[model samples]
Target chain A: MVKRLSVLDANRCTGCQSCMFACSRRFGVGGLAYSAIHVRSVGGIEHGFVVIVCRACPDPPCAKVCPVDALKVRVGGGVILDAAKCIGCGFCAKSCPYGAIFWNERENKPNICVYCGYCAGYCPHEVIALEELG
Target chain B: MDEYLKNILYIDLSRKRFWVEDRGSLFEEYLGGVGVASKILLEECPKNADPLGPENVIVFAVGPLNGLFPLASKTVACFKSPLTKSYGESHAGGRSAIAIRQAGYGAIVIKGASETPVYVAVHGKNIIFRNASALWGLRNSITVGRVLREIEGGAGVRTIMRIGVAGENLVSYASVNTETYRHFGRLGLGAVFGSKKLKAVIVSGKTMISVSNVKRYRELYDKIYTTSIKSSVMKKYHDLGTASNIIPLNTIHALPTKNLRESSFEYAENISGERLAEKYLGRRVACAHCPIACIHLAALREPYVTEPYFYKTTMISYDHELLYALGSMIGVKDTEGVLKLIDEVEKWGVDAMMTGTVLAWMTEAYERGIVGENEILGLKLEWGSVESYTKAIEYIVKGVNEFYKTASKGLDALTSRYGGEEFSLSYGGNGMPGYHTGPGAHLTYLTGARHSHLDSAGYSLDQETLKGKQLSEKEIAEKLYHEESWRQILSSLVVCFFSRGIYTPETVCETLDILGYSFNEVELKRLGEKILSNKNDFKEREGFNMLNQRFPKRIFETPTPFGLLEEKTLYESVKEFYKILKERARNS
Candidate 1:
């Protein structure tokens, strides 16, 4: 069994961007440039938000689309980015179906969610969660 | 070099030329946002520059804490006001501050008028001026935002600010709608934009800011985050947004209803926060870097008159000020009516507060036979009539006749011609905010630098007085001056005022310390005072005389929750305020 971050109910999201901040803080930096998780309004915020985070697929599309084999599939799920081998080309970000892959434009690297569930901790509305998957 | 405050973008709309200058010294002294912007306005703008002329400058400034901390979400816009014809400052909480900071600029100074309409796009260091001939005269601001969103990339970390027909026509109280829900909603920033022939500004970037002490930063971040989420002080804002104040203010009879003829509205319950949340609350939203989602949007569904099955759902943001101004002040009792009025104001890109106050005055004038039906364009002007008010808004933006043209200038100009000076309710040429709390509210409006309620928040003082606290006029003046001075520090941090409790002087110093800028409590307070003095100096230089303001007789006529505001007490408070300002000037 492995714990995975999940969007329980995205309609409860207030578009607070707390999860995005938490994701950025994991890198000891501020701003949304390097956040693994992303939240955006559906056209306008009145329609609610679309919370995009890696769903921890067994065979991640982001890992499959990597040009230089920089992204390696984890044991449980999700993918780990090997920054050394990466070409800084944004193919993985484009290939991710859920739009979960975040690009660090400053470094030209893909910031992937490693199923750490750090972002879920900051969601006050219980819009996201970390649960065991068997 | 300060990492975030590195570049100041200077855009000359007339020449279509743009350059980035290193403004490290400006940010180092003023620390950004209003502090930096006020200095820029003073330096660039001519002494008596026409607010709607090429001589006027528009400054968009973000602070040091902007991309580095939570709730540091406001971008301050400083300019010569077309409304006040003096020092103008307004703030909007959206992605604007973060986008500007990330876009690698401390401040953006826009000067000179463009020969034709245009929108500037700043994607990191790239500044592109696109012709906005088509965007000009757009009926709805939301459409302008939508069109820009498609044209401009940077989906997540970008802010699109646009104005509508009200701004295009140079309505004196027009606003610049940021993102959709948030706005620089006072003193006619949109009219300033219009004067420049600028329709929109799109800012987006991906820049990482470095923190000096990562460990300590995380600890303080966690502490602030925990406090913001768990603290009861922020709970009310999170739940019902600022509209939570409606019930409490109404209960205390402080809510100005129907042009301040009454202290409270009879149907306050209909438009109450509790009712709105229960019935119409579509969703809550937050500005970038803010954990508290205080922006409340109501879902308004309207069926097409021609098509039986066709319907349109619109999202309208509401708050305490909007509730008071558009809801109670204009005598709108229905929640739907209030939402509709707010939506119209949003679509037109006009300041809701000023629009409501102007309409309230007009309604009163019509009832008194001061302005006849002919002047009202054959439409009956009555309180609680949302349809009539809506039509008036249309006429105002259209500016077709003499009455509409005069009305577009604001209540000051309208009353100056129409013989309703007694109940004009404009302080320093800007229409009044919702609060008719007491002498404190009135005095702040008269003496505060920007003539904004947020300048001093005298309503809080009035509430404290209602709790059996007695204070002299001098004490009230001192408290106001101190609070407003402290707010300079807050606004420099570019933090939202709602989170003032979280960002105390000590906490502010700590946050700054993390960013490698050291300032103790004493140093911070001194800096606050300095900033206040600079703002007041700018205001004074612009011909704002504290003694010269005409007190509206209507405020004294109406009895507030505390009681009728005394003219002598208000005058004493103003005198005290001036004395403090003079003393501070001498000391500095």
Candidate 2:
């Protein structure tokens, strides 16, 4: 069994960005420079918000786009970054259909969610959660 | 001071130049947001500068708590108001504060006038003045937003603030719409933007802020977050949004209706929050870092007459202010009717309260035979008629004729040109708020720096009176002064006022302590007072004489929740407020 983060319903998203803050706060600071999960309006906010994150594919396209074999597959459905091996091409950022791979501009590296489920806890509306896969 | 908190970005639109200056001591003294913005406004704006001229300054500032704490989620915009022709300030909640803070700037001051329309895109260390001549004549604010959303990046994190045709035409109460829902909705910020030919402002950033103490920081964050989620008041706010006040206010005879001819509405039940939520509540949104999702949008479906088979659904945001201003004030009884009117106002990006209040005045003037069909462009202005009102709103934005153009100038210009001075509802030259609570509400409108009801929240004082507590004029003035002065602290920290109950002085000190800033409760109080006096300094410097505007006669005519208001009581209260303000100004 493997655990993964999931957006239970984007319709419940309020655009508070608490989940984003929580994701970034895992780095022990309050700023949002390193958040993997993101939520954006579908054109305009009146239309409502859509939560974007890695859907955890069986074989992620981000791994294939990695020229340096920096992204290694985790046991579940996502890839884990090997920071030392990454050449910082940002191909993984463009390759991800969800645009979930956030970038670190200073270091030129990708920030991948570690399936910590920390963000799900901060979502006041129950819009996201952690689930187990069989 | 933190290095990032000291950076101020200055842009001159006339020269198309931009620069960053470090002002650590200013932020250290003032804290940021309203405090810093107000200080900058006083320094940058010339004496008797035209509100729409190149000399006027526009300051967008975020506080230290933004991007680091929950509900510290507002950007304070300080400028000279075209509407009041005096000191102007408005607070907007969206990603604005967070974006500005993250973008490596404490504040952004925009000066000078552009020959052609432009929108400034600001990010970390880069400010791009993009030509926006094409977007100048866009049909609506939403269209302008849609066009800019494609040109600018940072979809999730950035804030795009833009104005509509009303702003382009220098409507006195034009609003700067942000994120399609929230706005700098009062005091003519949009008009200021128009004067400078600034169509929009885009801000987003990539930055990391490390805390002084990570463990203590997380603890405080948890306390604040949990406290917000569990509070019943927050629950009420989240469920119904601010529209929850409609039924209660009507029942208490505090809801202003029919241009405040009556305090209560006959059809209040139809436009009540409960009804609107049950029928048309489409979505609930929140500002960045706010746990409470108080922004409510109603799904309004309209069918094209040519093709009745297909209907388009437009999402319109609503609150008690819009409910009272556009709904009850103008006599619109039904929920959908109010939504339609709000849609029109939102499209034009004018202050909805000002627009509705303006229409309400015109409606009464037309009915009184003060203005005939010729004055109203041959359209019969009727109360509660959304069709007529929508057309009137379009005319206001289009400046179709003399009356339509004068309509956007607000009550002063309108009353001066036309008769109906007695029934004209305004407070200190600005359109009146929806409250007819009592003298406290009236005093806040008159004596508060910006003439905003939120300045001291005197309605809260009126609620105490409703509970059968008798207070004297001096007591009321003292209370208003204390509360308003204290609120300067919250605004300086830039926290949402909704969480005032939760963020006590002790809690505030704890949060600040973890941020490497230490202040005792007494010191914090003094800081708040100092900041407030600075705002008053700006107001006085701009030559706004509070005694100039008298209360409209309709206030005494209409029976309020407190019965017919006594003119003597209001006069005495205003005098007391002035005395307090004078003493404070002298001491400062």
> What local distance difference test score does each model get?
0.88, 0.89
Worst 10 residues of 1 chain A by lDDT: A39-48
lDDT of 1 by residue, B1-588 (tens): 356685899999999999989888888888999899999999999999999999999999999988878888999999999998989999998889988998988999999999899999999989999999999988899999988888788776789988999998999999999989999999999999998899999999878777767799889988888899887878899899889888888888888898888888999998889999999888888898788888899988889999899999888999999999999998898999999999999999999999999999999999999999789988778888999999999999889899988999998999889989898879988888888787778888888888989998898888888787778999999999988988998999899998999999989988888887878988887788888888888888888888888789989888888688888888988999999978876775
**lDDT accuracy of residue B424 in candidate 1:** 85
- How well does model 1 score by local distance difference test? 0.88
lDDT score, candidate 2, position B411: 85
On the 0 to 100 scale, the lDDT of residue B16 in model 2 is 99
lDDT of 2 by residue, B500-558 (tens): 98878898888888888889998887888888888888887877776665999998998
Q: Which predicted model would earn the best lDDT?
A: 2
> What is the RMSD, in Å, between candidate 2 and the native fold over all Cα?
1.4
For every candidate in turn, the CA RMSD to the true structure comes to: 1.4, 1.4
Clashing pairs in 1: none
lDDT of 2: 0.89
Quality of candidate 1's docking, in CAPRI categories?
medium
Model 2 CA deviation exceeding 4 Å by range: none
